[model samples]
Target: MKRPSLVLCCALLGIVPTACGPGSDPDPGVDRGDSSTVDLEHLAITVSGRAAVFPEAARLLEAQGQPVPSLDGVVLTVEEPLRVGVSDADSVLGQGGIGADGGFSVSEVPVRDIHLSLAASLQQEGFVRSSTIIFDTAFTRTRPHTDIIDARAWALPNAFHDALTRSIGDASIRAHSGERASTLRDAGFILGRVVDAAGAPVAGARVVLDRDDLAGRVYYPAPDFQSATQDGTSATGLFVYVHSGTAAETFSLSIEGTQAYLPRNAGATPGLGLVLTLYPGNVSP
Candidate 1:
């Protein structure tokens, strides 16, 4: 009896409820159509030899993470300067700085084939150590990095190669004020930083370890290629390892955070350690 009156009253009021009703399709919110970029930057590059080994002449970048050495006047060809153009060949990103360590760096470069034309100065000391480099700007998540022999039928018994194989860097081998005979031992080095796509340090990233830089070198310190941290680690800036001798100095490091190279002169000990942080928008850490 009361049901009839209640039903009529509810129907008249038009009350609608869904506390126990079937769910419907989710609401499609208004999407502002705009393009967003991941903001990836070119992989940083570094070297540990005389200048003019990279971007000067036509030399192939052995690995994707290899640094382009600074060889400005060193010119690839006596006729043309070492042009640092993108793989697209439209605009030329500015030249990277050549530090005292004879290394060059481009903080923000597109991930593309960096061509160094040095046909004119091929025979030069450090112009074309290997060959022209073909690289990709993609972040290194899968394969780490490897050095290519870059040997051609052109030069045999390369003096530099011989010196490196014999562990005779800085042939003159001067002794600094605080340097010692142990300094001549050639303790291998490890250098790197943790960075992001926007050239920023990303801390809290587990750092990993690898020795790809030392593979195939005739000698342990065969010129360039250091090892380092590779476990999930939040970088804390330049980490240096202090070990006893050159015998145990093989550190090829890669970081989930931004990468940075520790200059040779910058370190006083044999094994070097480093940790770098990454911030949003690739800001420097």
Candidate 2:
């Protein structure tokens, strides 16, 4: 089947465009761009616990396999700005909402001086309370995927955008805390379907995204943190494309249907022509 495209792990990082088509589809959701310079993007950040109760709550929630964003009730200040930082820019890419999933999305962001914060409003019968969390302003240095400019890259911007959005539950967890960085693991191109020597796509074959470490600093934009999918794939054997935040000097970057992940933090960027491919989908498997 001639599908559109899918970028499972697409985040907004400023860099030169390696291969951007002119007639690319317009951002489907909210438009966060101005007249100056802007690009529709997603801000994916890792929201960890800051206090004893918080982290414990997070772990408890995780154990139940509940979505982090759904923790708004347990944690206070769900409807406020708590995230702040000097992110790697890509964490705050695109604008608008694409409701392919239950969560809404938005793309088209102003390239200059980007910030993702949250605010809370209280309207209850007893002990009313309100607070807001503000994220640090992350400036865009350039467009993402510059080195791969020459690679025949194709992205399903909407799907990429959806996967990039954080649930309201995720926002609540990240709003109250300090910054905890995850090591940027070695990332590679994630194929939608397993292919044979003849490059024939394989269905139900399992094409996974893996890496070595988790050295990347997590950042959350306005809406939520990041997201995941345990659901099975379509009959076509396709999953979302994920970009590894990890970086490598001599690596095999897959140059096909995919999205780029920064193995590091929200705004960190490597040199141009950056990518690698790992066979069998494991570094030490």
What TM-score fits each model?
0.22, 0.21
The residue-by-residue lDDT of candidate 2 on 188-256, one tens digit each, is 112232333333433333232222222111222221224334342233333333223333111112212
Residue 213 C-alpha lDDT in model 2: 26
TM-score quality measure for candidate 2: 0.21
**lDDT of each candidate versus the true structure:** 0.25, 0.23
Best by lDDT: 1
Candidate 2 minimal-lDDT segment of 10 residues: 145-154
Local error of candidate 2 at 97, Å? 29
**Candidate 2: regions farther than 4 A off:** 1-151, 158-160, 163-193, 197-200, 207-234, 240-285
Best by TM-score: 1
Residue 48 lDDT, candidate 1, scale 0-100: 14
RMSD of 1: 23.3
